[model samples]
Target: MALGGNPIFNGKNFRGATQAPPVPQAYGQNQYGQNSYGQGGYGQTPVMDAPGWAAQQNMTQDQLQQMYNRPAAGPAETGRMTYDDVIVRTAACLGAVMAGAAVTLFVSMPLASMLMIVGALGGFVLALVNTFKKQPSPALILAYAGLEGLFLGGLTRILDGMFPGVGLQAVIGTLSVFAVTLLLFRSGKVRATPKAMRFFMIAMIGYAVFALVNMVMVWTGAVQSPFGLSTSIQIFGIPLGVFIGILAIGLAAFSLIMDFTSIEAGVRAGAPERFSWTAAFGLTVTLVWLYVEIIRLLSILRGEE
Candidate 1:
């Protein structure tokens, strides 16, 4: 149901129409790897530049000429994705979420719930703010993470109380999905292609509409069950909420794939380091959606039992 909120890229980093540059070749190289042709005893290579310079110097006359005539290094090669950068930023995001969750769970459930409502509201506002801002702000992104933590913590508590152990199950499930998706992405088993993206958009729209209608029914008391029509309907002897929950979880997983694709593209294109926050935010959003879906599904199953 587009559960985590609109993607932050929409207005902040990428407008309706903006594309990053092609992937760079020198993205993962050492900072000083570039070849510098300075006169130093003609054949005497400095220790720092020895390897690269020797390789160039050893080239055939025709090859040397071609190499010297090549264009300057592109942005991709000059400044690209680094494993360290992604790791540090991701850790920071997770830390914020955990810290926020801790406060919600240990201190006071009501306060935590209030914080979650605030976080949800604040996150929505910041998502729009960061999306539209010309430049990304680390502070805002981190703040979004914190707010989301509150929401997730409060949500986990509420669901956990009704369906004991669901919180831990959801946590494990979310991590497993993330790990598997990442492995597949790195191995090239899955990708975000034009066709898939198109389908995702259409499906997301339908899901959003359905959720909105369900919420209205729930709030208006048109359906007495906790989950409205979802809890009331059954298919193949299982609650419809369970079925919808599965679909929602699948959507969240696919959303992770999309997030990974975007991050890969950005890194290849030499996107500014600040974009790491955007990537973090996207992952957080997807994980939250995954957890929520799992919790709700568990609750539905428990209710049925």
Candidate 2:
């Protein structure tokens, strides 16, 4: 496991995954006394006219019955990760997010905002905890999702209150972008290449720096605009937030690709089944980021209008 490859697959927890044990090669050449053609190949071969292939191969009747009765091994049975595990876990995380969001969306603004702050702080802590932990904790991942949901709900509420209908627009925008990105990735139009990943890392750092500065500016009352410099500053008469938002959306999309790459690698490498939680967590984090960026962009646009 290594960072920058995909945050989800990084760290000690995933390092254990290696190539799967080789499947037993079928008893190749010829089984028992089976001949090259119709004729018997050799006298030393097991008798072909035996009661069963097992008997011919020297396996006892009990062994034959046990083998026949053995249940087929699945991902769960084999302790290997699978697409279904990822889907179910990711759905669970998103469901938790929605549950938390529902609570904040209907609450008073002050209370909602307070909860939002709590969630943001808690989510950040848990995110770091889950990310760096040698083991993936489902509880922590779900907690992160719930907290993010609260933060998103409060933020969306505030923005929607300021500019009516923007919330709906943002939701649509987020979903549209997500669907398009997924389609592109599945269709092989986009990928997490080394060159693209390098660009993603650089852009992520730059965007993070700007976000930190913007938050400080807003907090210190250095920028009166609701979106801080993103709104106060303009490029060609359009707020800087617009360009930044598009860039952020692209980054989020690329992040999804990275997540996909990690999941694919894990499956191919036969990573442990529990690692699906890691996949789910990564997807949840990326989706939340994407939604926040889309909502903020919509809010900025609406505010300008």
Candidate 3:
């Protein structure tokens, strides 16, 4: 699955899905006691009946025309993944996330904070499980989305309290980024080429290392700043977080491109319809990452102001 970058569609889970399954054939004996057309029994030639041919000729012109006008079978009919399937499943996942976030909104601050921790930890574990699972599970994927939503909702509540309306701004920013990236991908202006994939992987490794180090510093109380090294360090007169946030946002946006490519490949390869859940899960993960980066960037800017 040289689809580029997304581990979810890296080509393993879709084994034996390179082509659509063979359509079923009707079985019957011809007048000569040979297999009927498409029966192909015992290496014998299939026979078409004269009556069947005559019946086809006897059909009215309008009936024949109507039959000819019928649309061809699509991915759904073939039981393969389709863009529509991906869209529907992705919407369901996002909806579940919203529902989870709503729970945080109605709860008290303490409970919400506790849920944020649970969501963060639970989401991470589910993410890894779903990523490596050979089969996609709708329940697990939806659970992961909901947990992520709780974490986002709690974080947003805290940040919005500090900087009014930043949460809304971040939402808008995230959507804007998603729209622009999708447009670029649709327009064929951007693709996850092999060279680009290599670069992405390298950058991802560097970013992951930095994030882990930052988290460790924060946990150990080595950095009193809210964002650990991001706030404590400065480039020129500006906080380093501003730069880091921008970089993270860029990475997240590119990750969306990767997801789109993988989904397209999966559809083209005739992957099972159930695998659409995997596509949805991948998109949700990237979107969550993008949202967090945008919100964090907005918060850093607000704090600086």
TM-scores for every candidate against the unseen true structure: 0.76, 0.83, 0.87
Backbone N/Cα/C clashes per model? 5, 0, 0
Least well predicted 10-residue stretch by lDDT in candidate 2: 25-34
Off by over 4 Å in 2: 1-3, 18-72
Model 3 weakest 10-residue run by lDDT: 25-34
lDDT of 1 by residue, 223-301 (tens): 8988987888888887888878888887888888887777666665566555666777777767767877887887888
Candidate 2's residue-wise lDDT over 111-134, tens digit each? Answer: 999999998899889988988887
Candidate 2 structure lDDT: 0.80
Each candidate's root-mean-square deviation in Å?
8.1, 6.3, 4.8
- Indicate whether candidate 2 or candidate 3 has the larger TM-score: 3
lDDT by candidate, in order shown: 0.71, 0.80, 0.85
Report the number of the highest-TM-score candidate.
Answer: 3
Better-scoring candidate (TM-score), 1 or 3: 3
* Runs of candidate 1 exceeding 4 Å displacement: 1-7, 10-80
Give the residue spans of candidate 3 off by over 4 A.
1-4, 11-13, 18-70
Cα lDDT of candidate 1 equals: 0.71
Q: Give the TM-score ranking, best first.
A: 3, 2, 1
Candidate 3: what lDDT? Answer: 0.85
